[model samples]
Target: MSDKRRAFESPADLARPITQPVLRRPAATTMGAVLVVLRVLAGVWWLLALTFSWNDVLLDDLGLGDEPDFQALGNDVKEAISSGILNTVLIVGGIVLVIELLFALLVFRGVNWARVVVMVFATLSIIGSFVGWWLGGQEITVHTTLVTLALDILVLLALSSQGARAYARRPRERRARGSVA
Candidate 1:
């Protein structure tokens, strides 16, 4: 009778060196890529919130509320100042998010450089957030920044795993099927 499945491998076969690279992507790599995507989404969510209701968050911006002149300014002037600040933040922040997305795409494709970039940046961001909170008394609220911070930490961990690193560093397979690939 013909069998579709091959018999179990012998010890010699198992000990033989691997000539071909694996085609399957590791779970760690895929998870890291997905985490980065989610992190970018969190940034977009807050950016949109700030863009639309910036007036609410600007009451204490740069201590402008403490300025007698700023307080005395008409509602129109106050709104313009708030809008400017929010627009600046959104413009710069959006650019950063887009860059993150590009690297994430490469990571999903098993690119080692992109994985390194994502992990390094995530580490730096986590360190910076703690430094800001410690030195600058930056608030760490559970609603927004904390959630993103957790994601950053998770991304760093996922991309740094051995499975993810090995998958990224493995030899790339040639696309042409007829030749020795």
Candidate 2:
């Protein structure tokens, strides 16, 4: 067979095992494993926030009392929830959680896109978290937000490393070749 045709051989014919050194060095594996743990924890927090908020809004039904405007906003939110606005919130929150989980899984797989995606998402979340903490007027939330922001910054920095950048770029390279007519 010609060399070009040999390259396109059936899977059965190409089944010979070829030993290769591990691509990820020990340090990279250790660092990546730590990042995966952090990513999973963050993902869980966001996922739980969605469900927790949904449950609180659904069961407690605190529209006015929870608002800064007290009675007026509370009454308005209550009315809105009663009128199905709460459903919209739940739907949106669910979508966000699902996307978060998808990113988490990708991070677990050491996918480069997950790093960029999660970094952007985490940054936005840090802003939202701070805003929510401030608006919440709760000391505990403020503390939590600070810790979360710190962790997110670390994750972004780690994902910006040479190894992470390479992982993310591999797919782009494949696409570039695939796109050539």
Candidate 3:
């Protein structure tokens, strides 16, 4: 070996693997996660509204007019409709809420796939809302519809931010290096 090459020896552990550290979660990602949680809260609001006002909601949904005399129906019919509406709401609403919660948690963890999934859902929701409104099928109330729309918009903006996207799409080595406690 030449004198320069023999001047120093390489570290014995140079070939061994060394874990890299993962950077902290970005603010935009945190915001996106929080926005998702807000969406879940909106879902809860709808569930509660349906739970408390199933009769009026059922009437409105079924085109029974704003002030239908629903009480005039026979007891059996009333009970049947009431139970059906409540049961449907509970089943469907509960499932959606759980799924939203799971996605929110996943987004908070900086999972790229989760972020993309949320973005897709948000886009769909925005488009569907506009389409339904244009067709005179969906109502956009200030208290309910508008609030949820805002949440979805915010979620999209946050998750689609440069910082959020970079952090979420970061290499697996960076992500896994410091993931363990």
Candidate with maximal TM-score:
1
How many steric clashes between backbone atoms does each model show?
A: 0, 2, 0
Instruction: Please provide TM-scores, in order, for all candidate models, with all chains considered together.
Output: 0.76, 0.48, 0.75
Candidate 2 clashes between residue pairs 3 or more apart in a chain or in different chains = 63-74, 64-74
Taking the tens digit of each residue's C-alpha lDDT, what string does model 1 give over 37-141? 999999899898877767657665566768898999999988788778888998999999999999999999998889988988988989988998999888888
Candidate 2 has an lDDT of 0.57
Q: For candidate 1, report its TM-score.
A: 0.76
The lDDT per prediction is 0.83, 0.57, 0.81
lDDT string, candidate 3, 47-67, tens digits: 888788876766777665444
User: How does candidate 1 score on lDDT?
Assistant: 0.83
Q: Report the C-alpha displacement of residue 31, candidate 2, in angstroms.
A: 5.7
**Where does the lowest 10-residue lDDT sum fall in candidate 1?**
13-22
What's the candidate order when arranged by decreasing lDDT? 1, 3, 2
- Residue-level lDDT for 4 in candidate 3: 50
Worst 10 residues of 3 by lDDT: 13-22
lDDT of 2 by residue, 97-154 (tens): 5666666567655665576777787678667767776897645343255555776667
Query: Which scores greater on lDDT, model 1 or model 3?
Result: 1
Model 3, runs deviating above 4 Å: 1-22, 64-73, 174-181
